[model samples]
Target: MIKQIPVLDCCTLSGYKEDELLVDHLADYLHKHSSLAFPHRHNFYHMVLFTSGGGAHAIDFTRFEVRPMHMYFMVPGQVHTWEFEGEVNGYVINFSREFFQSLLLRPDFLNGFSFLNGIAQDGAFQVPAHMEEEMTAFFERIYEQVNRVKPLQKDLVSVMLLYVFMRMEQQLSPAEKHKFPVYNYTLLRNFQKLIEQHFTNLRLPKDYADLLYITPNHLNALCKEYLGMQAGEVIRNRILLEAKRLLVSQDMTISEISDELSFNDNSYFTKFFKKLVGMTPEEFRKNKA
Candidate 1:
């Protein structure tokens, strides 16, 4: 019998339950007929390092062939499913909202890579043969720290993981790294993170500025400079994207999507959707369907 797997929740890692970090030797865990799928509602991000084998991985409606030495990253709320045909060896790092918030606050660390945002769409990092030794060394250090006996070893391992990510990010092209501004990049990153976290509850630019301890004008300037759009436009785009996703991907009614997004009423939400999307929500969903 094919075992029915429950949907994995976001905000917490649910599928692989072992608390201790260890290398998952794929031959031990994967079954020929079994597959893994994640929940599409809650928001928790994941970074996956695939060291061997190949498979098909799906994110939302997008699918990719997972080959050896490729790094795959998935954002929260993106529905993901995977099937393996052969050996699968990898490390998956799951981090919570607080973890990402703290990282975004460090400007020097995150500002140089605007290409990171594009990772969801085209974000696979191919491990070069020359770089493989360095990558292996870094992963070994991470695994050692993760499995260490010290009480604070996990925290230390988290820091090492960030370092590893930085090293990997450095391998990207200069054009990719320069996608966003370098100055106040930290603030803009934080704002984007906040918007991702609170898009349903807060849509105003001032709300984000207040949380980041900056003026709305400053936030607007950063968005215009780096994102090539106004700050409000980014927020609205996120909201509308979610609205359309829920509309087409799920059975949620139009009123429910509207209410979930916190509009005054369905009519107002419809107008908002129409203004930006150039089509009503119903029309967009219908066209997509």
Candidate 2:
């Protein structure tokens, strides 16, 4: 049997079975819950602000060096693990998708944040030193408001979270903001979401296009125009990303990974991997090891 990676939920982290929203200081949270350092995928979104600390955080397949004034954003289903050298101080916000979609009444809310999508760029950002106080206040308020749990606490949480997102968006490079498509981008967003959910079973661009109610030609055209790649390439890249993740994060052999990823055979899987990565899966694993 194949080994299964751990998938954590908000309840698991906070140990508060009823609450979907949890906020706590980084150091205290880590000390209180020792199991969080292990590699796991969460079912809820996470926002971490590091006021003081130095470490590296692995999200999905990529490793990001964490430092002061840096905030890391994670969406549900991305595998994450962290290592901190010394005393770490910060704040963590964990919220469910329902918190935003149902409570906040924003269905496509997460799509608005480029960093959260994990396609345009990595999910970590360095905040300017000058804006330290302003950003800290946002988290502080969130911590206080979360603990209060008044009648309108959810509403308060929703508004404050939106403010935090807006503040971070202002810090993004103008080019980064304008480079990707803005208007009418839902089609692409929906296509990407579908790819994430059904990549193992659905490998064809037309497969996703059909699900999105658009022609494969139009999908390819939009991908080429906005993302500078064919729709098929986007699908392949998503698959490739997951392949790399499983290869590196787990002890599974190439054959096992091929089977898990639903490839026809190990030979075809190796060829497909080497074509895009320029290295066979075995070679890549050996190099990483």
Best by lDDT: 2
TM-score of each: 0.61, 0.80
lDDT of 1 at 139: 68
Which pairs clash in model 2?
none
lDDT of 1 by residue, 261-288 (tens): 8899999999998998799988987775
Alpha carbon lDDT of residue 121, candidate 1? 52
Q: Write the per-residue lDDT of candidate 2 for residues 1-289, one digit (tens) a residue.
A: 7664667878877644555878898888888888654667788988899988887887875777778878888887787778887788899999887787655565877767767886524478788788899999889888877775564457768889988888787777332555655543778878888998999999999898899888999999988987789999999998998887677655588899999899999999999999999999988877755
Model 1 quality (TM-score): 0.61
Q: How accurate is candidate 1 locally (lDDT)?
A: 0.64
